[model samples]
Target: MTVTVADCERVQTSWFQLRSQVLGSGSWEDDGLTWANGDLMFPRVIDPAALARGVERARSEGASIVGAWLGLDVDPRPLAAAGFKKGWAPWWMAGPIDLGLPADPRVELRKDAPGADGRPPRAWFAAARQGGQAAGGAWAHLVDDLAGVFDVEVPEPFQRRGLGTGLMQAVCAAAASAGARQVVLNSTPAGYALYRRCGLQRIGTGITWWLHLPS
Candidate 1:
């Protein structure tokens, strides 16, 4: 299915909800979303100048700045020219629900992994070795057909063992079971290459900029 602007909005709403739970101590308004704990702000469909203004405002308030843009068209040159450090952000990947990525038999799938307030996982997936020596994890909150894969990670020792792919497959399955027709995820710069191997296509790229502050 082709992703549209409205689809992006729906997925983004779900993302903000998931991040608010995961990031903790964050605020969301009509203008944008902010995670106070991470000092991150995600402005909605704003231009480079507006984004720069927000960064400047945050810096003036004694907060180090981290900013994110949702789609591929993002350009951080304005922020960099304004003095913020520019760096690569995660790539947004999406594909049909059945990515054909296999789930490793050695990875145990768990439904009750720890979550906010020790409550039952609203939506979570974990893949771990029997002895717990290696593990991979991913999370999401499904909104209709869009399964926003919030985050995925595997430890250094577990790298290249296909555990990361298993974790992704596991999460995609979970989302499908929960009624998702499509899967979406933000791939870390490192995981971007890893995820592409699973038949998922990079649909768009997001930009992030950071400014360090003196303690």
Candidate 2:
């Protein structure tokens, strides 16, 4: 059951959709643009024309900044020409949910309860503490049997102590317990090596283009 790049893309989109819904924001697909409203909005663009339309729409809606996730195959020249500065290069990685890292005793995993209507939550959060102080945290979203991990962070002072790996182990364990068979994540350069050590392979790379509209 090797996951393809397309599978990773679908899971990423699902994560964003669930996030937008949970935040009470809106999302829509117009032409080649997939727009989701959030503090860090990524309007997935398929081509130069879609990028142009997305910029116009963001400006019309009074957004100060917006971003686009361009897959490796998408030419970034158009984005740069459109005044979008380059942003982070995130590696799309995926692997079996059993990451094999021993969980740290200090890490606590928590899952949201089902809604009043009995609908299960799409995501859960994990946090790691050192001496009863917050060291790091992360979020995992499940869409069907595939889970996507997001926002794994450890403070500077608390870093280099394996808290990041511990947080990942805890979240993957939680996802596996909840019936997820595979996990996917977009890893920045900082976390890329750690994720590789956890047995996830980089399936592809994506560039994020950011734009600040004129006032």
Candidate 3:
């Protein structure tokens, strides 16, 4: 089945729910459809009219206005004209198959336990180099049958070592273990190639907006 913007929204909603659980804030749907995750993240506003309302509310409350329009092919210049900075424009990818973990013993995968201070459970897959230093790490949140991957990063020295592939495999394993049936994520321009290599197919487009970088 072709994934649509609604599917992307489901992934985003699940992600923010997990984030809010960890951060002690809950997300609410504003203007009937936009999802706002408190002040921690921007509201997902699509309709220009709704976006205007959300923007005004954000400005009035001194909260950063940042959000995304997924799969909608809307021109973001209007939002840019409204004083929001256009951030990473990502391609939404989803795949049904789980690319299994790598057999290489040089890298290890570990699922970090929840913090003692009441943070919710999150999947942290660290790819350790042969020398024991981490080459990279990826974090994910699995809600029901959907998993949203985020913060996949590798240091410059670790590039070209296939650490990213290992991280993707580990993340898929963790998500499947948690009963996820499909994996969804917004990929960076650099990550697009990596994710495609790992069996995920690009399904849609996503763009984010920000008011100001917090100090």
**How many clashing residue pairs appear in each of the predictions shown?**
0, 0, 0
1-215 per-residue lDDT for model 1 (tens digits): 78654464467555665655565534344244443433344444455555555555555655554555444464545556766676666577777777686777866656645565875444756665735566667765567777777657777777787777777777778778868888777677677777677676877666666667555
Q: RMSD in angstroms, all models? A: 4.5, 2.7, 4.3
TM-score of 3: 0.73
Winning model by lDDT: 2
Model 3: CA > 4 A from native: 33-65, 73-81, 112-124, 213-215
What lDDT does each candidate get? 0.63, 0.79, 0.66
lDDT of model 1, residue 178: 67
True lDDT of residue 34, candidate 3: 51
**Positional deviation of residue 2's Cα in model 1 after best superposition, in angstroms:** 1.3
Clashes of 1: 0
**What is candidate 2's lDDT per residue for 25-118, written digit by digit as tens?**
5466767667776322333435678667767766776778877776777666777888878888878899889988887998898887877798
> If scored against the real structure, what TM-score would every candidate get?
0.71, 0.86, 0.73
